[model samples]
Target chain A: MSKKINLTLKVWRQPDNRTSGRFEVYPAQDIDTDMSFLEMLDVVNDELEKEGKDPIAFDHDCREGICGMCGCVINGQAHGPDAATTVCQLHMRRFQDGMTLVIEPWRAKAFPIIKDLAVDRSAFDRVISAGGYISVRTGAAPDAHAVPVPKDSADQAMDAAACIGCGACVAACPNASAMLFVSAKVSQLALLPQGQPERDQRVVSMVSQMDSEGFGNCSNHYECEASCPKEISIKNIARMNRELTRAGVRS
Target chain B: MASSNRTLLQSSIVRKQIVAVTGLAMVGFLIAHLSGNFLIFAGPEAFNGYSKKLHDLGPILWVLRIGLIAALLGHVVLAIKLTGENHAARGGRYAVSNSRGDGGFCKKTMIYTGILILVFVALHLYDFTYRDKTGDPTIVEGVNGGLSLGLFGLVWNSFLQPWHSGLYILAMIILGFHLSHGIQSLFQSIGFFHDRYTPMVKKIGFALAILLAVGFISIPIYVNVVRTPHL
Candidate 1:
């Protein structure tokens, strides 16, 4: 049998993006240790609903940790304190009974809080739309062997492709830089042969979009890599730098 | 084409490259300076001769001085601009902030240490380069057959003061902290990364920081505690 524990929750509450937010205390009773952190929040919301109070608002989807829809700063760490784990995957067992958890939304000028925890991540979409895709024939899938990707390049590309578009990197960075996210997007394409045609334009456009959206410059803090659920390497950042330089020289 | 080139230069990454390049140039200047300062250990004759040789470079010395000043200005101005942008990016402060242990004290405190070093450099130039101590008893007149600026005597007298030596030692330690993170970061900014070589570079950065700090500190310690003034 899994052990049961209680937690004192201090969650940020705001009516809308236009309003200022403050922490509101809520008691979480009999939370199972095996319960995921979001599940524990679910129980708290249920209790609030039963009492005819406005339930706490948070963003979560595909509780399996792959959707990248769920995340919040838990006790000063993005996606809780567990390394390489998303908020949906974080379990209550990681915490002690009666511990106080301070939860807040991703705080960045680019990611404004919509209500309480959910922020407008449309900035990332804008960056992606800027030049995150390769132009190819859309009707049919190309044969795998036709591309002739090198094994080392394929593996590196796969590693870079693991980013889930989660804003944890922005939340974790002291400067709120999205370099890790932008770099990963750049590296995944730059390392592949299929990404060759528009490679220069892609990096330049994406980086320009990222900056225009008000994200900070990378200071090489490596905090994004530390807090990232995908454990993305900062080497991707260096790769993006090289790509930008290549693009600049060509232009 | 010109507009695109201008855009590339204005981009955040390119600005960082500028900072990194200028920072490395300053580090180069520091290394050359520390090497020249080491000649003080060889006694006043050799030390003053080295100063005379540098002064004899004349126009070349002016070129170097101008280049160093340009690098310093570029580093400072661009760093301040980026720092402001970084501050604005994070719209609000975290009520309870904590580090993930990724960047330690030295990495996070770059601006503070850099500012301190800037202040120290100004004071150092004022004390040695710009100051006139013509009538001071500590001055060794007619040194290096009157061909040198009595730089050795100036340095020796300055370091002999406990407070002056202490200030220099403190500034060197701050510079060490700045370079420890800076040396490795410059390579990263320039897009140099490798599985084996990056780690090696990091180690070299740390070792160089310690070496520079210790080397610079030794002069003051020797002057203040080790060497006895001629009575």
Candidate 2:
């Protein structure tokens, strides 16, 4: 049995990138406790459609916390207040019945608002396109034991590879830094055997791209780790620094 | 090749490394200064003797002074540049902002505390090094019967004023706040991190900060409240 609750929603509404945004209040009556946060928004959007009002625009895909599409700052926390959870996975049971939820888009110079809650995240794509790939040829599936990767290295690489590129780290940082994201990408590839050939070039290119994108430098606040949906560690940042140093020395 | 190296130096992380290195060098200078200042407890003869020795070094002391000034300028200039870029990165402010409370008050207000300390340093140099506001003409006997300025007497007279002691104590407290975060942050900035040792580094940094603050503050308290001018 699920309990029904009424709530007041204060959502940021911007028509386009050219217009400034403002918060608009909407009454969400009889929201189910079992409903996901995005589902609650869907209910509100349906009501707005029936009343001939424009639906609140937000980005979502997969709705299973892996797509890295759904995100918004809820009550001053990115992806709501849950640890290791995305906006699509956040349940309404976490909130009080009459609580007023304040939602806003990701605020960063590199991530401009496209509509209401959807900011352009192509800056991350641009960073990836810079050097985030290994350039080895793949003819067929090779033997798993050919490379003989250490278990510890393999596990650490997997940990770094868990980044979903959600841009929540940027939103949560006081300086809007993307170091955690870029470091994770750099570390994941740097730890593997196949990543050895282009290690120096990859780190240098990705870091330069990240810097040019107007992302702030990391001041070691650890806020990004706290707000991360995948529970990424800041140790990756230290590793990235070491990798940068190694690249500098080798080049 | 030179141009490419220059580009690497201009990168955000490398610039931060420079800031960290220079900041750590200042920390070393502070420890040396505090140790020398502790000689004040040994009475006027010992304190003035120490000051004379420093003055006797002549050109070497000037070199050290110039090096320290260069370090301070590098730390301030690069820090301001990074802070401006950081401000611009956040395109706008949040209506309802909340911190995750990662490093607390000390970590967030580095720039503000640093500026206050800079102001205090300027006034300190003016009062003690350049200008003699206190009209004490006491001269201490030096090696080879040479006479040196009684730095001990001047320090004591300046500290006797409540306003001067109060300002000195306040500046020390601000320096403590700056070092509490700065000590641990410098290690991380220079690519040093560990699961077990990093926590130890933080605790050591905090203990060092508290020690330095209390050590500096004790001098003024001793001069103003404990020791009489005649004694």
Candidate 3:
């Protein structure tokens, strides 16, 4: 069997947000079909470097799909063409030889272009800073089961915990809203006994943060979940709403 | 940025419930209003009389509008909040790519339709309530005791216009798309997915959204296509 194939790649290039960006096509030949998509890009980047041209810049952390950093729209789809996986895990086998790929950064009003393919995702950090954490103080070691929440509740909370803090929800959303991420964080803690102290304040702080981030509002489109690598259910949204409504802000 | 363990947040059932309850309520309002407006088919007096009746109980109408506004705000806000959290939780980038909601047809995009409907709502209110800003929107049935078309002729005349009727039909089509996804998803949101009832609820949702959308659209389509030529 042939071990390598030729391909065409269109990558977005920009020096930084202050400058304009455009697509640059690169020819990839004799590339390992078994290589991951990022690896293929590395091969392309290496070739570009040999020619003294600057390589394309994109974001990646773990490359294991756990860190939730690697992402790009391949052919107009968020995260390439795979379901339930991050872009780092995507392999080149999915594409046929000679396929022309168009890659771009996450397009949203809230997510600005930082450079090349890398986008400014600090807005996410701000949203998290708003209210994504528990206010509990550090203490000596406690029993793992010290907080005995109901088994079902614990399980559901675990599901919310599955959220890897990926911004795919925002990318998938037309409004670029991050309600799912906020709700998941809110739900995960609120479900357990440890989350009680902050329950009243969680919803308000988190929601306010989301709005301040300039992210668009969700219109109840389930696209976030369908494209969500974690498959996080939209149910978290309702739970957050109920909590916010019940807790009703102080002001 | 709440904790990851919001137990209720994980329940798809809760999401469905919220979507269904809110969507159905809004649909109910649309139907009732449409029925009242249909009286305009009787001519200007009927429409104006209906408007007067609604205005007579000023507080009641105000309450209704307030409730409706609350519902709309709540619905949109929750949706936005969830979308934000989801984005943050997932980091807004997938390692793998799959376009779940992207299809070759408009029927697949509830979000798109929802946005369109939102714009339509703004236009709709402007055409009716704030018509004063646009110079009275051409009073349709002005006559004894009323300087305006009297609510009936105003509504009927709205349907009679080619542009207005076109916009109405287009908006309704998008509204239908939004309803089909929203109603069933609401059931899922609130955790109403029993094997015995999930299918039934879905069918019910499908029927209702399509029916309301078709019926409401038909009124304008009929007024424009069939009634206008005859007159």
- Separately for all candidates shown, the number of backbone clashes (residues 3 or more apart, or on different chains) is 0, 0, 78
In terms of lDDT, model 2 sits at 0.88
Q: Give per-residue CA lDDT, model 2, range A73-139, as digits (tens).
A: 9999999989999999999999989999999999999999999899999999988888889886779
Candidate 3 residues B154-209, lDDT tens each?
55577888888888888988887777767766655443445467778878887888
What residue runs in model 1 are displaced by over 4 Å at the alpha carbon?
B1-6, B133-149, B229-231
lDDT tens readout by residue for model 1, A48-123 = 9999988888999899989999999998999999999999999998999989999999999999999888888999
Best by lDDT: 1
TM-score per model over all chains: 0.96, 0.95, 0.70
lDDT of 2 by residue, B1-231 (tens): 001223678788888888899999999999999999999888776887888898899999999999999999999999989999999999988877777647479978988998898899899888777765224434322322333336776787678779989999999999999999999988888888898999999999999999999999999998877544432
As for TM-score, the candidate ahead, 1 or 2, is 1
What CAPRI-style quality would you assign to candidate 2?
Answer: acceptable
- DockQ for all candidate structures vs. native: 0.54, 0.49, 0.15
Angstrom error of the Cα, residue B153, model 2: value is 1.2
Q: Using lDDT as the measure, what is the rank order of every candidate, best first?
A: 1, 2, 3
- lDDT of candidate 2 at residue A146, scale 0 to 100: 88
Superposition error at B152 for model 1 (Å): 0.7
Inter-residue clash pairs, candidate 2: none
